[model samples]
Target: MARTAVPPKKTIVKKMNYLTGFLLGFGLLLSGCNKDDDGVTKPDGPDPNAANLDVQDFMYKAMNLWYFWQGEVDILADDAFATDAEYTDFLEANPNPETFYFDVLLFSDDRFSFLSEDYKELTQNLSGISQNNGMEFGLVAFSNSDDIFGYVRYIIPNSDASTKNIERGDIFIGVDGVTLTRNNYTELLFGDNATYTLTMANITDGQISANGEEVTLTKEEGFQENPVFITKTFDVSGTKIGYLMYNGFTNEFDEQLNEAFGQLKADGATELVIDFRYNGGGSVNSSRLLSSMIYGTNTNELYIRQRWNDKIQAAFSPSDLEDYFAATTGSGTPINTLNLSRVYVLTTSSTASASELVINGLDPYINVIQVGTTTRGKNEFSLTMVDDPNRQGAPYIYTPSRENNINPDNSWAIQPLVGRNENSVGFSDYTGGFAPEIELQEDLENLGVLGELDEPLLARAIQEITGAGAKFDFTVEMPAEAFTSSKMFSPLKDNMVLDKDFYLPEIQ
Candidate 1:
């Protein structure tokens, strides 16, 4: 069971189709009763009969105990409502339950905590499963302008977009033949549509203008997304430069990632460039493995320190808080450690979570030359908690379960910010985001093929490695009349997460 950590807010996930089978099961189990506080059988026990009020009660109690900022929730001591309806009425009159219970209940300025009623969809997302059109994009506008332009960052292979010959660096100015204004872009890009017609654009006189090329693409169910998008070794003036365009920290492809590193090591690569411009983050274990491979022979060293809430801190031992690097996978598979003294990274505002972890975790032991724009500042991680009473345990439960691991009957689950992560030597102060030593934006003016030496961001990294020592600027002036979407097109929200060995058992 992998914990779904909060990704950079910019990533846009397509709305999921609920599991009809689960809904049917929920409907069938609604009549079953459970032991309430008085040990009397009641209609609400994590079942469909558990109304919104019942669910809210569960959420309140769970957050009171497990939330990282539990002490700040003054409402914890006010759970004195006699019935579910009374509790509902109290919440309605509070005027700030949503704010107090959900948003403000987290550490100040935290935006990672999220609630979901679709546990199946969330679980699938954690496992790298989702429906996607296979195009990842970034929205850019001139400073302080509402007008935005759509920039193609990358295209997933074998996706509908790729099949339509849509390539990285392609710019779109309109959707469905309508000029893309900031007002209509979100609806046009993320609308519930089976198909889309994209109008292309080109840079003319330093301005984005319509190119009159329309490409129609359709969306389909993309089951599993492999994070290893591109891996190659570039020969840069006799220096073997290894380049890996890794996008996420999914554990399913651990072996494949190891193989990529193995290839670079076997090729005797002297320099490395990790492209994380669009990576939001994923599995903490995967982060550790990647760091271990990069750190090479430095296995037992502490990679990250996870600090839970004060209550959980006192309950768990020191061993539970420390996450160290494993030279090999748990099954004793030896990882390919690059053992490089310095590693170059390409980033953007979207580079976050486990991606930042890799960069920060390796900083103490190696020279991490950050290239490209600043990274998304997310140092905290979250865990997915369900409505299982026993799992939430003691003081938090009013409806006790007779069985130990009975699954929940409803889909409600919460991915709350449970802990903050720090690297070795306690270096975790990058809230505003980590800026690049060699700052350069992606060259949308003259987009180059990805994994190529001439690509704007990658080119800068190579230049740094070769000691050419030249900095390039790719920032463009904001268009006078443009619109940008609030969020970029992220196929999935499950980026960098901490993989939990156990999951709250399935809802019955």
Candidate 2:
């Protein structure tokens, strides 16, 4: 399941109502959401004074109010700025909002928080829609130099890369015939160009060199990737093992995910394996539902606990502080549950955010046999917010009920680390990422086909399952370090996000 919120520090929060009394009177505190015509609750634009406020003003106010580490950041103190002028001056100190956001507002410990130039793009990204060639690959640096080569992880079906000659396990050392180096790779490969060529490479004797091959790939506009990448059932000595190579916890594809689970259940699959080796993360709601499908749909059990900031968490009851196992999809469709007690999770450095959530949240309930390498160590989740005038887009879930109410003044959006997610037993400390029980890393030279049972990670999992197979050598010929993956280029990078619009509970 997608994770959200860390356990709050030891601080006594008084019993307060939905914090309509937020002490900061900078006029940036939410006065609560507004209802539009037909009496539907919608986002309110910023406060009256926010009309003239710049983007930095928006960033500072949002960080001060909702940043998970607000209590620790001295600059974010409620009384740090005694006068409104000082607050405004602090915002004005950095004219560039992005600069100010990175260098100042964000907590140093936070690694996954993000800011975007356009909320529309950010919203589409969180939903798994983006402009892309759809070749999901990971970059690895050469052992000697800053030069990096990319190994194809997987190809998105119906994508430009899918039609091209490039496939999983292929290696590329350059873009448009230019040898890729650390400094110019971003500009050459991920620039605004709609199309580019990948210069193929091969590794031999621990030496990576160009193979004199090139493939041109084009970025498709509005490419929508389904998170349910590969789903199949493996018959292992009369025991049915269902395998799902899920890529993200995207909420828009929840129906598809449910259907995949339904297929596994239909196949009489008793054992389950979820391959998240390359999955970064997405919607927490989807993660919760996905977990419920694997585990039982027991609404009584807590799936995840959220520890909000002291300013607002006091308003929540114990029940409100937690997200329980869902009985059905948020759309009310009955979930197709495998109800498996033990699950095998395939992970890598790229398996992160919600992927880690599934591992951590289910740890207290089920046997999660994590294979492959450790994860990307993100225990926090981000809230999708736009520059709404209403408390500067006070984080509400990016749901249909409310209009995003984006301040027409700007197109910027911010996904701040607002909560720390813990499982039922209060285990939220995987910031260094979850270590694998079956410590294995992908063999770059022999990156096998994804689902055909011969893929190294999956094969190793099968070995652990059937118990009749001989051991295979886990060796790597490439001498390099994994830098990043193709998902890093996506607008929503390593995010396990809260999609439900959260306006503070009806102000008492």
Candidate 3:
């Protein structure tokens, strides 16, 4: 049979009516609060700084170019009745309005907002000032480099002490008094740090929850990084399992990974469980490095293929391909070809971007298993941080590129690539997420296995790797008719096992 080539799928379309309704409602909601302290009315006008600058300058100077660019593009393409105004008209008719608008807004409002908020929080935490321009904080790093670590280190307000309120050594226990556990902390910390009243005991205190009691500590200036933590190896039956809890793909993350893997391997680790319940994304290179280490040199292809705009395609140099290939085959100890793979990844709605990349990259070569909910469908790769000429420093912008579709021959062997811009290309293997071989949830009220550790997910994964039976099983008798209609009653089936004895599949 001749196989038909699948066109890329369209991006998910959200109903704009709800958005329009919400905007109108929000306007009405704020209408009553528009008065100043003396009850005098105020007029809406661009700030002096914004008014004096060129439109290009305003657009490029904004920090969040991604959101602003989309809005500007909509104004140009959708708002046909709009006057042929200076900056607005130029953006609408441009060859790549999305990219151009992203550059402009990224320079103008987005940059200013991000810096302002960062500064505002810094001042509020340090000087207890209610009003400030909010200029003290800055982005320290953002990349998908060789290392898988992303960081946003802000300067302490009005002090150069080696350690600020939330210094390098402080362990993050909670955010806004919401206690964080292994599973959801990654999503909570990504992007801007939320307002949190943190409580901390001395690191050496070794504190555990008391009977009907909680510890309340002092408030301090703090920042949150993508959640990444290390824990002790535990025994499931007779097998030893090493756990590495990863939250996101940050720069230089591979180094941290290597150290964890090395320690676990030395400790006679036989199985590994990686938790990605709330990870969003950071670097593709970081994902590649981890995949390479797990699959080893014998594996040829890393990712199936990346889709990008024609401009991006033209920009690709020979070194880029070479570097990608080298990164996939260069690091880590080789896995025994004959061994059954046992890797458990916990996922949820927040598991997206590079998280999907890791799953698609490793599934074909290893005994990969997914636990928990479906993954967020975000297979489209975007080139963010484009430079804008109007900004003083580097004008960082995020733009939507092209679509990527993996060849069918390589789809199962390599990771599946679903198009974010097109609607027809469905991710059949795992779009919403891969269903876990075993499902479990923790009970938070009892704090038994669910306090943030997600004991149930971890325990089930450990059981599968160790070949251990369930510690407790409760069966409720049900009617046959009920069983027939329930999706949970579906018959068990066999999966097509990839033959490792055969040659590794080549990238088509």
Top model number, TM-score: 2
Provide the overall lDDT of each model, using Cα atoms, as 2-decimal numbers: 0.65, 0.74, 0.36
Q: Model 2: per-residue lDDT, tens digit, 1-508?
A: 3333333334221110011111222222443234323343322223346435557766766676677888888877655664455555565567787778776876667666777787676666555567899898888887789888888988999999988898988889999878898998888878899999999988787677888989999999888888899999989889899999999877878999999999999999999889998888877788899999999898999999888778667655677567888888878889999888889999888887888888888888888898888787777765656555454324432333345465677677777777778889888887777878887788888888999888888988888878865767657565224787778878666766665443344231
TM-score attained by model 1: 0.79
Q: Which runs of model 3 end up more than 4 angstroms from their true locations?
A: 1-228, 235-237, 314-340, 380-387, 390-437, 446-454, 473-508
Q: Candidate 2 at 32: error in angstroms? A: 15
For 461-493, candidate 1 gives per-residue lDDT tens digits of 888899775555545443222122212334335
Q: For each of the candidates, give the backbone clash count.
A: 17, 19, 39
All candidates: TM-score: 0.79, 0.85, 0.47
Global Cα lDDT for candidate 2: 0.74
Kindly list the per-residue Cα lDDT of model 3 for residues 1-508, writing each as its tens digit: 1111223234332110000000010100111114434453322213333323233333332222223233333332222222224333453444332344434323221211121112123223221122211112111111222211111112233333223344322233443455544343444333134232333323233322212222222222332232345535666566777776665565434566656666766767677777775455445555665555455544344444433233222333423322122232224533222122647777654455566666766665576777765655444432222222221211222111211221112111101011122111222234334445444432212212221233566766766676766674322121011101100011100001010011111110
In angstroms, the error of model 1 at 291 is: 0.9
- Compare candidates 1 and 3 on TM-score and give the better one: 1
Q: How big is the positional error of residue 103 in model 3, measured in Å on the Cα after superposition? A: 17
Error of 2 at 261 (Å): 1.8
Alpha-carbon RMSD, candidate 1: 7.6
Best by lDDT: 2
